[model samples]
Target: MKEILERRYTLTPFKKEIKGLKDAFRRASLRNLDSMRKRGFRPKNISYYEEVILGEKRYEELKGFSGRIIGYFCTFIPQELIYAARAIPIRLCSGFYDTVLVCEEILAKDICPLVKSSFGFKISASSYFELCDAVILPTPCDPKKKLIEILSDYLPVWVLKIPQDKTSSSKEIWLEEIKSLKERIEDFTKTKLTRQRLEETIKLIHKRQTLFRQLYEIRRANPYLMGGRDFLLVIQTSFYDDIERWIDKTEELCKQLSKEKTHFKTDEKIKILVTGSPIIWPNFKLLNIIEDLGAEIVCDDLCSGTQSLYNLVEPDEPTTDVMLGAIADGYLLSSVCPCFIENNDRIDRVLNLIEEFRVGGVIYHSLRLCQLYEIESHRLRLILKEKKIPMLTIHTDYSQEDTEQIKTRVEAFLEMLKR
Candidate 1:
């Protein structure tokens, strides 16, 4: 075991070693997916989402896709522009623990696990990272900004500079950045982004957002119509699934959920509101622990979850510039990420979700070395305390070493909520 660990961490691992690691990661992903699928009664329509996350179905779909495959990092990158430019945008955020270990060879040990995991995929040529013709990255934090420098070595990387403040000047600056991104994408795809194309794409995504809102409302049922793990899977899959097909399937899932009977009684389990760093697929340790402890996560403020779908692009006019402005505003202004200097919006958003979901308690999940979410969690905890709401902050990474600890803490938190 000691020799194997040393070989794995060596400066130059053999190609066969990398392949073995990739296979291990895939098996781990499948196991997590299977466990999540079996946890609660899942609507049959949701199986499509599981398949997409598993990579096979999405790979088949993208194999036949007619446009350039554009990979993006953060939700702040406007997807409407990619669709308008006749390209497919895949969110490249990853949560596989094995990949994080692979990245430690290059990235500093103190870096956030999410960044390491994502960079690891590129290094290992795992998942869809190899399929991307170009990558778009938003600089929300220091690690991500550095990621742009590192990833540029592999493919064409377009950097979208995010503003720290949300002011009129900041909006103007961001709007210009969006315009620059449009020109870059258009140049890369050799497809002119016309007013009509942008308008059509905006309308199409608006429809998808509407379907997401319907699902969100359906989750508000006193006895959850869908399990939190299953719901997270649906949202996470949206990062890679074909938009039209995802919308259709999600619409069907919502209808199926509307007719299905609730499984647990309202009083049998406590409602939980999750907030903080994005919990990408396969690293669902926090969510699984919460649900396994007899609590249901009715809502969350994670960028990877509800925050990605909550806002809509409301263009005042059908013109391309107006629509682009709307997209920029929707991504920048509506974002509740803690990277922004003023986090009052995040506080208000969490408080609103707690009331809206009738949450009995809150779980603030922070990935190790992710200072943005960790610092914000402290202030948020103080506010929640004043409201007499229970908030538990769990600091963890992609590894499952802390699974038992998290479960123990969550179990205790659920007990407190019940009391």
Candidate 2:
């Protein structure tokens, strides 16, 4: 029944239209690229404003404005906090004015370079700290903790402690932390965040998230109606501070997908799910590499992928309460990345996706020296092996520069899966 569903999805005429829609997006991206450059922009990484028009200037330019600026150390911080504070909350992932130089001073050099690079970017410029009113660090991992320690020394850093244990008590800890986070935000911003504001933010976010999830569903509808590569661009374009534009893109993409139908070629027998921690940025090359090797990347469970697909917000609930609930839940909990946690349910979720998708294999991407994900890689391989699922694990920084070796391993893995 599942295979039949997959087959029908891939071959339908709708899939063809969907594929066309994906191609149209690429052309659109290119067409806009020159204009984007004129607007002082780049690709999905930095030109998000150009991509969606979130006001012409960079988000940090409002220096004279008395609005507080909240910085989240990762992607998981509740956006409602920023909305509630009447402040701009930016994820501390990238696009800083300076090179990172604080990692070595605060953290062990043995950790990943990404963390180091982020620190370098921040410390490279003095103005980096000037725009930040406070830092929200979710206790998701050691690197994040170290990042908080370093940033706190320079600015107001509030740490939201996440529970290491995967139990009912975890929810309790999260609720208390949410309250604490609320108080902290109010204290620092001198803005009274009422329940109504929080609730409003929740409704807005929920609407946005629902559209985001639907876009993924369209992307996931297979024969490859939508190019996963293009789909990733849609996802990464939302990471920055453009809430309105993000929502617009989501709606537009959904409308486009709904009107079209298409699927990717099924010439390659091998199909797999790419698994890893949160992909800090979108990398379309990973999808390209697999397809180039006569293999199909049917799905991914990365943070920037399926793991981001979340449930809907209740319409009857108060917006702030829903916002509070979202925080208490792990939806926006940046620190609870499955790679950094010891939860078996996450592992099980991966396996289930693999099974339901009828994936022939699993490709585990572990960032170099990303200790938690590396550990999970080994355990996952064992579990997959027991299930007779061929697996390949690769370690590298998330750079397109490493494509050659990654391609080789991916090709070899697909060959093994084929056999």
Candidate 3:
């Protein structure tokens, strides 16, 4: 009993090693300024990460500091839109490393773990909440919507609502909402989104997107020149880093990856489709686990992956209309994830991916206490089972504390499939 408890409670050597590597990478991210400059890595996404790091660094650098900062909650909302509007869009991500001095009462105990963690971080004086000027949350889930409503009193609040139905296009509805959002931002920042400013923003965004495509193409080439885990870090960094410099590093990496292949030639490997939420950068343990098991994650239904498939409007397309159209089409897809409201489109997406990839099994990962994914997992599993496809369900947190259990379950599932 003692041995089992110890093994379960104690962090594994492998986990520790992975964490150390990530820490080193993070430190490298901070120290490689000269190399980044030499490589002409002027990605705006890199700057985004730097800005947040710098925000915290600036506070630490100065003896005592206090100023306006903004917090944005939820993912896949195109925060660059907010940045162009002149407000720092800090993602409200947190974990167990927090003290809940202020957020406990407002957020409630039953709220989503990530939201609770954010509140705890705010209360604990983790510096994330201390610098927040406002909190913007999109309607990704019911809990999040409620979170935003409650947070309005505590801070400036902005709610980005996604259209509910995809059967009939809601282009006009979304366009109106964008116009309303524009008005609200103008009021909030006292900055106007002039034609020139919008154009500049578009150009910067276009450059970043182009670089992202190039990087992904390199990853997709046979033998996956870059490891899945490393590629995920680059993706996560791209989200918050300075886009231009990140682009430069990505371009360099692409040149290196071009000569390599993406596949492994191992026998008895199970080809799997990773079905679940987006596995963003800096938190790629899940994908690494799959690869380590001799299972290939050939495809994914993550927003961080396929969700960025649609291209932005052409330069000649009317800016307002194109932007609105892009937002609507992207968000209003039939395959929209359950984070908003689990609809039929998600099921269709599962079937489509399975057929397209010729996947042998599906690994369904839901973060611990992620209400949306957890609730939908059972139904998803039933559907897959009915289709005679093998499925594995694993729960995790961002910090990877439950990796061993997840791996055991995954191994067992793979073993069963082999028989």
RMSD of each: 6.2, 13.3, 11.0
lDDT of 1 by residue, 1-419 (tens): 01101222223322213767656766877877766765556688776777788787677778777779999987898899999988999999998888888888866799999999888888887678878999999989999988877776667788889999899999999998999999898888999999999999999999989899888887776437788888889999889988888888888888888877555454456889988899998888888778776788888988999889889999999988789999999999989988889979989988888888788999989889999999998888998899999999999998889899988888988888888
lDDT of each residue in 1-419, candidate 2, tens digit only: 01101222222111001123224333434543432233211123333434432322444454555677776765556667677778877655542111222445544667665566555545543223346777777766677766666655455668777677656677777777777778877877888889888777777778877887776666555525443444554555555545776787567656755665432344335667888755543224455677656665667776655554354444456656655775566443333265335667667778887877788888887777677787778878888889888888877764457889889888887777777
lDDT for model 3 comes to 0.57
Clash tally, candidates in order: 0, 29, 33
TM-score for predicted model 1 compared with the true structure = 0.93
Could you tell me the TM-score of candidate 3? 0.72
C-alpha local distance difference test of each model: 0.84, 0.59, 0.57
Q: Estimate each model's TM-score.
A: 0.93, 0.76, 0.72
Q: Which one wins on lDDT?
A: 1
Q: Rank the candidates by TM-score, best first.
A: 1, 2, 3
Between candidates 1 and 3, the one scoring higher on TM-score is: 1
